[model samples]
Target: MGEVLQKRFPDMVALFTGLGFLTVLAELVLMDHREGIRILAPLAAGLGAGAILLGLGFPRGRVWATGLLLLVGGMGLLGLVEHMQEALEASSPSVVRLVDEEGWEYPAYPGPLREGEKEGSPPPLAPLALSGLGLLGALALHARKP
Candidate 1:
């Protein structure tokens, strides 16, 4: 069992890292259709492709997988920090004005707002978690002897 696991560890890490990239790509495509997605989408897709290639036991698979995982993990950490900051700032009863899709303005919280609560989209926790998992898996693979 140990030998089998050691032999397949890199492949497993690469596969999971690819899945993580795909998750981020899907999130960006579905939830965020901003103009910047044109660049981000393709970049994410490329990363996912690279990860899959690495999983196929390429010559530099370890390097590619490690680099991609670290990059995604770093980005997720940055986004998590930003979201935490926003959440902290939002933990107050403040009147928020929002525009509807039909170009109508309305208060976000019509009734009495509670402290440390707001009506807004939640943070991208899924991607953050996935990235962290991928990073850890990559690190584990890196630690193993090639």
Candidate 2:
């Protein structure tokens, strides 16, 4: 079993990475990229695809795969930071409510939804998934180097 796994590790990595990228792509598509920053999501998918292709035994595959993985990994880290910041911003109180002697309606009260009332912050840990995948793929590719 050990020998078999050793021989097929690269193939396994490529297969799992491809599947992960496809899942991420589906999520990004469903979420709809209306903002400029959201472009990174699709870009990561494209880069991951390229890296997977290179990892599959192309000429100089290891070099290209490693480079792309590093690039995407860095992007993922940056995205993680950006997402955290956005979450912080979303959680921070944007408006100060001044309640006088009269009772002021609480924002969290169970009532009709306000027009365009936005949802909670984006999942802060989402970007870390990409970063992890990038680093994992990079490590696997490097380990396979002759």
TM-score of each: 0.58, 0.81
Model 1 per-residue lDDT tens digits across residues 68-99: 75675665566566567666776654567999
Per-residue CA lDDT of candidate 2, range 1-146, in tens?
99999897877886688678778877888888446887897789778767876876674778788889888888888888888998998888555455657777444434554796667888888987777778877877777745
In Å, residue 81's CA in model 1 sits off its true spot by 1.3
lDDT of 2 at 131: 79
Candidate 2 local lDDT, residue 69: 82
Candidate 1 structure lDDT: 0.60
Model 1, 123: alpha-carbon shift in Å? 2.5
Q: What is the TM-score of candidate 1?
A: 0.58
Which pairs of residues collide in model 1? Answer: none
The 10-residue segment of model 2 with minimum total lDDT is 105-114
